[model samples]
Target chain A: DQQVKQNSPSLSVQEGRISILNCDYTNSMFDYFLWYKKYPAEGPTFLISISSIKDKNEDGRFTVFLNKSAKHLSLHIVPSQPGDSAVYFCAASAFIQGAQKLVFGQGTRLTINP
Target chain B: AAGVIQSPRHLIKEKRETATLKCYPIPRHDTVYWYQQGPGQDPQFLISFYEKMQSDKGSIPDRFSAQQFSDYHSELNMSSLELGDSALYFCASSLAAGRETQYFGPGTRLLVL
Candidate 1:
């Protein structure tokens, strides 16, 4: 049972353009959401995260939008750079037992073409 | 700028062999999590520890066991390894227990021959 889903397996965009990746979740119990960027052979790096109470969160060049009613979230990168090309994973956090575990999506490979 | 640390970046073992992987959480982090990622697959949660105790369990197999030490370092021990056990093992640490962001280690790649 995949509680988190990223329907798009891959995305491509030209450098200096905007790139948007979407994610959906089936579990409403998730109280927090995060997006992680990973490169080949390396661990995923923390990108950005939003609380379930918030609708939007933004960092320098990255923004995350959450739609609680739809159980959907999206990450947008403005003026994409070549370094932005990597696998993006959407993860949801839910409290279980005494700890919180992350449910990760299949991931979408974002390719920024230079 | 401390990150989670994992030892034995790569391990090659034969079937029925035993192996142990170690992880050191970032300073002041109180929770540790284990995840397994196979080729072309998303990471799967295995287990988690909080304050030197097992707090949660997931899809971990019976042949696997883990423990968190007083120093906050953790170890995952696998016995009677199988071919299907080959994968990248990631250790993540969080500041607290619930609703916290986890910082992951570089991961240990295990190959069962």
Candidate 2:
């Protein structure tokens, strides 16, 4: 079973526009959500994260909003740059058997058009 | 800014062979995680270690085993590899076990023919 899901496989936005990526989860035990950006042949790089207590968290041009009730979260990037184009993955964290492991979504490929 | 290191960026083996993948965590990090990303699929958790001990278990197969050394580096050993076992294996590390930011390595691409 896929605990976390990213419905959209890809998204494209023009430069200086806003890019929004959405993710959903079925497990209620997850209390932390994170976003990671990945380039081809490389590992994922951490972007932003939000705890269950907070509805939103922002750092610079990146903002992540979480809605526990909906079991959903989103990453928003304002004024998108071409450099931001990459595969974005959404992951949820939960403790299982005394260790915390991240469950990841399929990932969405985001492209920024110049 | 140190990062996780994975050796043998790419490995190709015949079916029924064995493979060993290694990971070196960043300085001062004590927890290590292993994940497998199959073709066109999201990463799936395999196993994790904390302080040189097995801490968490995921979807790891019986043919696979892992261990963390005293220096906090980890290794995943796979035996009797099958064609379906081909995938990109990633190793990540964090300061501790729970709720800490994980730093990932470039990943080792293993192909079983």
Tens digits of lDDT, candidate 1, A1-114:
899999999999999999999999999999899999999888889999999999999999999999999999999999899999999999999987667979999999999999
Clash list (residue pairs), candidate 2: none
How many clashes in each structure?
A: 0, 0
Isolated chain B TM-score per model: 0.99, 0.99
DockQ score for candidate 2: 0.86
Docking class of 2: high
Against the reference, the lDDT scores of all candidates come to 0.95, 0.95
Clashes of 1: 0
* Tens digits of per-residue lDDT for model 2, B1-113: 88999998999999999999999999999999999999889999999999999999889999999999998999999999999999999999998888888889999999999
DockQ of predictions, in order shown: 0.85, 0.86
For model 2, residues A26-61, the per-residue Cα lDDT tens digits are: 999998899999999999999999999999999999
Please give the interface root mean square deviation for model 2, in Å: 0.7
| Residue B113 shift from truth in candidate 2, angstroms | 1.5
